[model samples]
Target chain A: MNIHEYQAKELFEKYGVATPKGVAVKASAEYSTALGQINTANGIMVKSQIHAGGRGKGTFTNGFKGGVKFSPNKEKAIENATAMLGNTLVTAQTGPEGRKVQTIYFTEAANLGKRPDGRDDEYYLAILLDRATSRPVIVASTEGGVEIEQVAHSTPEKIFKVQVDPAVGLQPFQARQIAFALGLSGDLFKQCVTLVTRLYQLYWDKDCAMVEVNPLLVTKEGQLLALDAKVSFDDNALFRHPDIVALRDLNEEDAKEIEASKYGLSYIALDGNIACLVNGAGLAMSTMDIIQHFGGSPANFLDVGGGATKDQVSAAFKIILGDKNVKGILVNIFGGIMDCNVIATGIVEAVKETGLKLPLVVRLEGNNVQAGKATLAASGLTIVSGDTMADAAQKIVKLVNQK
Target chain B: MSILVKENTRVLVQGITGDFGARHARLSIEYGSQIVAGVTPGKGGQVFEHNGVKVPIFNTVAEAAKQTGATVSAIFVPPPFAADAILECVDADLDLAIAITEGIPVRDMVRAKRAMQGRRTRLIGPNCPGIVTPGRGEKSHGGCRIGIAPGYIHKRGKVGVVSRSGTLTYEAVWQLTCKGHGQSTCVGIGGDPVNGTSHLDVIKLFNEDPETEAIIMIGEIGGNAEVEAARWIKEHCKKPVAGFIAGATAPAGRRMGHAGAVIGGAEDTAAAKIKIFKECGISVAATPSDMADALLRIWKG
Candidate 1:
């Protein structure tokens, strides 16, 4: 559901919010044309569009190297872009594998003056789900272009929060209040308020999990602009908003996660050896915890969800077995609405179809549990059945160690 | 008398014509829930057979409630339509409504909660296994069967069982039954946020019930509802209570179980809740079997 910075900026721009004029280039030809389009003598900022933060560190582009430098020549921005395309860019923000460079955005760099009060003129504003309040809260701080979590921890008082009512939506007055709290006034402040309001509308309308505009910059000329933007939509709400779903860039995501989503299975790949397939979310986590507790690491956290049918379980099995790192499989179900026997049959069938060699441990409880165990027992695959969670974890750990 | 539902309670089914609705409707009737009427948006004036009872179907909850004098409503509407279904039952002045649908949007739940504010109607879950009372009757409005919990385990005893987990609740009930203990009432409050009731809310009712002796609480990771209830149990509630929280060492920031059953932050965890519950002098069960043993010890002592 997370979108790159350029995509978020495009959404902001569409809603009449002022953002730095930027061109997203994927090819050398497009990059050369972008250089002509910007025409700013002050030089342009070539930002590597990655989902992670802290792009300024040596992890990406050798720390930007003061202005922008091309490999062949500065004028051949297209050649430099071509060289950068499809390359993995490391950053303090990205993981060990490094985020792949999919699109490079060329934007006119901003030169904003310090505030009249001798502080940074910009501020960070993010709308995230506030579980405590059970609402989407707007988090704003005078500190711009930094992790909001750090600001929340270090200077909690400086962070201004407003819980938005989903029914009434974010009011213009609430946006104005936030703008004023960030020390804005007059037409520029009003413009900032208007932009924030629009962003809130976009957040709700698009069913976004988060809409963050870090460093809402106030230029030396007193113009307000969103210097950086990031938006993440709720994947569950994607069904209602097909347009946003279309904007998804699958190449930028974890391949395993993408594949799991295709099967309607929620899978988050982890660094472990045992691949877990559980019925409920709670049971899935419990299985993972018990696995870890028993000196075994879970390769992935996969929940087929509560109403999972045979095909979904079969597809989930394929996704789990597909991972080469998975040495063992643990299938746990506390079937309520879903039948355990159906899941057992699906797992057995999926193992046969996939020619799975991993050790399998299953504990099916609740509806049709006996039938489920009977089905697994009949399968030629070496399936281990445990009565309790502790027993299941113990058996799985033993099986994994035996391997 | 049982806590929320009994044999005399008239039941109205929302989304009754749907596949799940029809399936559970038949099972509930066989299990002894009063087969009053069913509500499906255009399926009024129709009757479905359950045992020997012929239950009439209506298009709306209001009309069904009026005709059958139904006191409890069991909703089987899809997730998107679940909130409205609960609201309709609330509007009809039904005493209790149990929603079986899962995956309702949190925003929709917020609205539903606001609508239910100041109303007498008690909502159970938009994503829960419905409540059950053993032989003297049961309400399985959700797609679950009440008969799954053996009638022998429930001896009309003073023990009250409340759980956020549906399947696990039945496991605990079955365990208690094996130990010659029957429940006064077993309520599955559900794990979803914006559910009909909380552990604290149900515990308060159980505390007031004369037939209820001890209580068994089953909670999961995600919300602070357990912490809130534990705080309440520490100060109020004179009876002994045993607690079990699922998912002790779930990874932080990863949602494991129910969409609402996620550990929202590091603190709102099963382990953290267990520690707090222990501090509150509540018997903590590490496993389902252990939960039953803890309850028995409390009851004996």
Candidate 2:
């Protein structure tokens, strides 16, 4: 899961990596604390806290200049924050609709540019999986603040890689090697070594899938700092790190998605009108595919897993209908380990409670399929049952188009 | 002989006391798999009896393999300890180990894969349906079910199937079986980004097997396995191959993801992979029934 910049910086401090002094403004009311407290002789960076990248290049839909703005005074900082709070920030990554900025990070902007020892030269640093090696790798570049993908694509030689052994871990010697590679000297080299080691430790200890420090900087004082922080933890490992999970912001997530997760259902809202409910992740995608192939667009991707209960199935229906864009529903279940009858009961339960308005097409296969079909049929509901996946997709498309 | 498993493949179960472990163990044995022993730490000397058949439980895979001389192990350990479970089987020196558990951390899988490199054991999945050889279910029966695949949907024949999905594999096999194109063996390589076996691994085994006439390869989005297999088939596969890719309609990127989900590699989307397969002289199936059609068109006049 992705955490905000403030949380990532907090982790950086906890792990011995230097970061610009920053405070998270929980709401527009708390702008005073964020603006007044941070010591920014260089300037204050009014950074809009969203989950996407390209924030510096992105503009707010509310006619703000940038998601991040460097201002000289507290008044300007609060003004930027006021413009950013609750406004939509559209980045290349955030798509056209954009993400609603719920919080803002007020950070001390640094004195950027070349120092006497070439220490102010910013460099890109990130630790992520090099899938080919099946190991964690550090990608470092002399060019910083630019997209690392662009750098890797343009000048391949400038990008340096250090593969950290999963079993042996990131060795101190390796960290030193990276420090030397970045062309650091003396105390700066040792400080970089410490920062690199600390970054590795945070990544390994936190079960983070990736830890990126864009524009990992060196101050005029020969100090190493992470100018930007983006770390995402593996969701599977989240159970072990409740402290990290607690950093999750509900405002940053889609309400429908959060509700679906509570019911143990995997659901992603889309721009279509036909809602898809299936058993496995693969099957769910295929169901969506056939729906599109049949000239219908899927409103969402919903997978209830192998052993979902009747209540979970009911919850899935409620969540699917929660979207006003949904014109029809398609339930395609191939119950191998899952029972079809249980799914059918859930469908029946959901319809009885919510009183279905939109047309729902049902296709049940595999174990206890007859019982499942019987349950739907006997419920006195207008659920359309198809013989095959293709038949069901076509039926849903026809039904939705008619509406 | 069929690839990977047959009637003589003695099996050992890891994490045998759990619901999935116990249920699948009973199903595998009943479907004629020679399940000799089970392992659940601290539950040693216990017996899980199903339908008049008792499976002896051991504390360690080492003990299970040693006492039973089991060459194959099926894993049902929970996600947290699953990699260690796989490591246990790998260290025990089993011929083939299939991990039936899902939700294992990718890092653990990477470490497990690293450890298994150049090892004697061949691992199948950490979240797969496992392998099944048709016509070896029992001493006299016609199937040897290793995973949770529905036994009713298979029949012994000349086609070898390898897939990354569970029930979708069943879907394809059912379509083939209904059309008189019985399978030799079907293996689910699991759907995770990092898994034990690849499509090429199973293809290599199927290519060498004389009993297999045609191969059916099932793949989905999110990985390079299917594309790699297409390359391998173009270069070395001796038999005709039929291909099907799930998730033709999978969203290109993650749902509000930050990183790690945005993969630049493997443009192995359904259309892309199908284009690759078609370019590599492999038949592509758009749907489950299309799989049967492809196999029949390749094998028959």
Candidate 3:
């Protein structure tokens, strides 16, 4: 689940990560009060708290590129923040959403000095799975921040990796190795170690898929701090961690996805008219490809998953039919552990309940195929049956086009 | 003559007290699997009859394995406790462990894999339809029971089949049966990326089987295992092999199918794997119906 920048920072603070002291103001009046809360005003950065990235560029309508005009006069800061807050900010990273800021973070901004060598130190730290080793690996780079994928791909050697054993967790010595490798010493080095250790704990404790601290900056005073943070939790592990689930901001998620989650079905909305519901993930993807291959677009990719009961199938069907864009429905089941007849019965029941009028095409195999088809046939629903996947694709494509 | 299991192999059922587990356990025993024992933590000391065979229930896999000398284990534990069950079976040094439990965390499987790295124990799946030794014996942990493949399919001569999909494995076996070619062993390695075993792992066993003359591999998208297997087959496999990858036309991106079956980034795709297998001199079946035809051609040649 994706959270807004302010929410992520809030979580970081809760987890004992040092973040810039700030106040989140929802409205223009709140912004006036926010300025008074800033204890020191060397230079305060008013960041639009949107879900998307790249908020720095073209986010503000009036193009306050250098910085928002902040004065002891709280009225000016409020005027500037209100204009940027509600208006959509189109950043390269924000994509098409161009996040509409609900709240803005008015916080103390940091000023940096040159490195020990009179050069800027560039480095970021991230902990992610090392696919090759099948272990959690810590990634540290001299080119801190920006897109780490690009750095890993273009110059992999520059990214220092240390694999952590799950039993021992992330050892301090290993964290220190990364710190020293990144050219840190003294108090700053200790701070870096502490932050890295904390990040690893967050990754394990929260069952996070990734914990990234971008721009792990070494200030002019040689103080190490995580300037930005991003944390992603494993959706499968959400059952074990209720606290992380509470962090989910439903407003930030796609409406269809949120609805699909309620049914315990994995649904990803796509721009297509034919809703494809298949039993297995591999088969579901293949069905989507087949739909596209036949000149039909798949509206959603829905997998009922293995061991799905009749109710779950019905729930999945309802979710698919809920989409107004879906002109046709394709039910593909290669019943492994599941009974095809049970699935067929569920489909018919779901369609009856929803009063589905869309063209339905089904291709079922394995256990109870005959019984499943018989049940569907007996249902008297206007359903089409295909002997094979190719036939199913053709029928669905033809039906969708007819619609 | 069959692969991992046969009529004589002693089988232990884990999670036998559960609804689906009990049902399949009864079916497998009725179908001719040698039901030796059952395991369910608190349900130990109870007796479950499988086709008139009174099997003693044990508290753990270790006890069941020790008492019954069960070489093969059919695990039906739920997702949460599946990893521990598998580890227990591995600890007992079972010859083969079939994890019928679905939805096991990939991280858990990763740890299990690490633990079983050098062990002789072979794992079929954390989520898969359990293997069958044709008409002689079957160990089905999956809920569905369509009956075992007919005895006629086992000419006991050659042909080793490996598949990622359980349903497709049945199809492949059915196709082989129609061609009057019986399988030496049919292995469902499972579709999950971090599953118990890979196609390459099974192929090595098949390659070493003197009775196995040819190999038919059924693979799906989402992992590089198929590609790696193709490379291995090209370099090391002495037996003639036929291959077919399911989901050749699968869309690019994450789609709900199997937890491990998403096509993200660059990896072994159906088409790419097919191309590789073809380059490796293995005949590729274009469709499920054509799989048997492809294998027949290789057998005749």
Candidate 4:
């Protein structure tokens, strides 16, 4: 659902919001060409295009200093791009394993306007759903180019929020309030109003979950430009927008997670030993918790949904086993609408199909639970049967630790 | 008496002709719910026959409510039109509208929720198991089963249950049933962020209900609805309350199956919510299996 900075800028331009022109390249050969396409007169910013924040402070696995580099010329730009592309970037957001930087973005570095006190005047603007109000809210602040959470915690007064009515949408007076709150006036104030209006329009029209422009810059030419763009679309509304769907980068996603989605399974990869397969999101999450509570860590969170057929179960097993960190597997089902017997038969067939070598624990409850448990018992497999969630978690932890 | 629904509450089915709607409608009727009318645009004057009971169908919710005197509606329309279906319920002025449809766009819900301001209808969920008030019968057959929850797991008693997830609600209900504890009513408020009801909303209803002696509130990581509910329970709720928050190990910024289960701010984590529950004097369940036991730890009945 998240798109890179370049793609977001493209959207900003489409919506008539000004941004520093940028080009994204996948190879070092295209790095110079990409830089040529942008206004690199002042300077070129080589940014690693991965789906995570804190790129400026990130380090490449190849001992490179920074994921995002400011190069004064084309030679240093290519050097920075070479160190980033095809290298893994470790940021505060991307876990210790890091995300592979597959694309490099080159953009023109804007000349930052200075305030009366000789400080760079940067501002922050973001549009997202305010859950408390159940409406779209525009968060604006005078402090920008830094973590907004930090600003919120340190100086709560500096932050200003304008909640828009979903029915009426962003009003002109509301846009003016944001501009005035950021201390804008004259032409710069007019530019801020236009930018805010266009961004809000893009957010609503594109069905974006969030649209954030950190360090919303004021250039020396009296223009407002979005320095950094981070946009994420609402996943449920993606069905209406095929153009947005094409922006999804499979390389940035976990392979097992992408594979699990194909089977209608919700899978999130984690770093642990025991793999958990459960019905329902909350149960799956608690399954992981109970595993850790019993002195074991879960390798992944996989929910086979309310109704899982035989092929989906088999596919889930294949996806779980795909993770090398998995030392054991736990199957927990609290069938309500779904029959436990069908789930049990699928588990039995999945175990036989994968020829699972790791220890397996199964817990079935709800409709036709006895027949489901009986199916698992008659499968002639070494599947540990658990009477409850607590018991199954303890069993799996003990089995994995014994190994 | 139940808080929202009972044995005598007449119900209508929206999108009754669809596969998911028809299936749960049949199940609700089989569980002895008084399903009086069906609403399918252009399918009016038709009768849906199932298990010796024939229910009349109508073209709109207004017609369905007027013709059948149905006060409650169970919506199973698809994602695209689910919002309009909710609006129809509001326009028809139904007493309660339970949206069983999943994958409704949040924007639609926001608009629908805004339009519903000052309205008379109380909406339950867009992606939920619906409400169930167990009746005094074999497998609770005479109970008002509004949504897709299995009726047999419930038992008519003094305990009230509220949760965000469907199967987890069933898990807690079954746990209580096995331990010889029955429930007055169980409500799933759904897992979406912009749902009609909140944990606090249901908790207040349960606290006010005289038949509800104890409460079990289940929540997950995401919004601050659970924390808000817990804070209210500390100052206002008189009954014993037990709480369990899922997604303790869920990574940040990942949607854990449910769209609303993602950890957003510093205050919405499972650990934070659990700590708040403890501070608010609500017994926290260590695991999902311990929901009933947690309540029993604080309350004898």
What's each prediction's TM-score? Answer: 0.88, 0.93, 0.85, 0.99
Ranking by lDDT: 4, 2, 1, 3
lDDT of 3 by residue, B160-210 (tens): 888776656766676676467767777767656578777888899889987
Cα error, candidate 1, residue B206 (Å): 3.0
User: Could you give the candidate ranking by TM-score, starting with the highest?
Assistant: 4, 2, 1, 3
Could you arrange the candidates by DockQ from highest to lowest? 4, 2, 1, 3
Model 4 agreement with the true structure over A140-178: per-residue lDDT tens digits: 999999999999999999999999999899999999999
Q: Give the 10-residue window scoring lowest on summed lDDT in candidate 4 chain B.
A: B100-109
Candidate 2 on B1-301: residue-level lDDT in tens?
7899986788989978998888888877677778889999999999978868788899999999998899899999999999999999889999988998877887888789989988999899868889988773322254677878777678888889998777678778877876777788999888766777888889999999999989999877765778888999999999999888776666666621111223354474678888899999898876654777887777771
lDDT of 2 at A233: 88
Query: For every candidate, how close is chain A to the native chain A in TM-score?
Result: 0.90, 0.93, 0.87, 0.98
Which portions of model 2 miss their true places by more than 4 Å?
A: A115-120, A180-189, B136-142, B255-268
Give residue A221's error in model 4 in angstroms: 2.4
List the pairs of residues colliding in candidate 2. B32-B137, B135-B142, B136-B143, B137-B143, B137-B144
The model with the greatest lDDT is 4
List of chain B TM-scores, one per candidate:
0.93, 0.93, 0.91, 0.99
DockQ class, candidate 1: acceptable
* Segments of candidate 3 deviating more than 4 angstroms: A1-4, A14-16, A23-29, A33-42, A46-106, A113-120, A336-338, B136-184, B190-193, B211-223, B240-257, B262-264, B268-301
Question: Clashing residue pairs, candidate 1?
Answer: A59-A90, A281-B256, A281-B257, A282-B257, B123-B196, B155-B182, B158-B213, B222-B262
Model-by-model lDDT, in order?
A: 0.76, 0.83, 0.73, 0.93
Decide which is better by TM-score, 2 or 4: 4
lDDT of 3 at A98: 58
Query: lDDT at B160 for candidate 2?
Result: 94
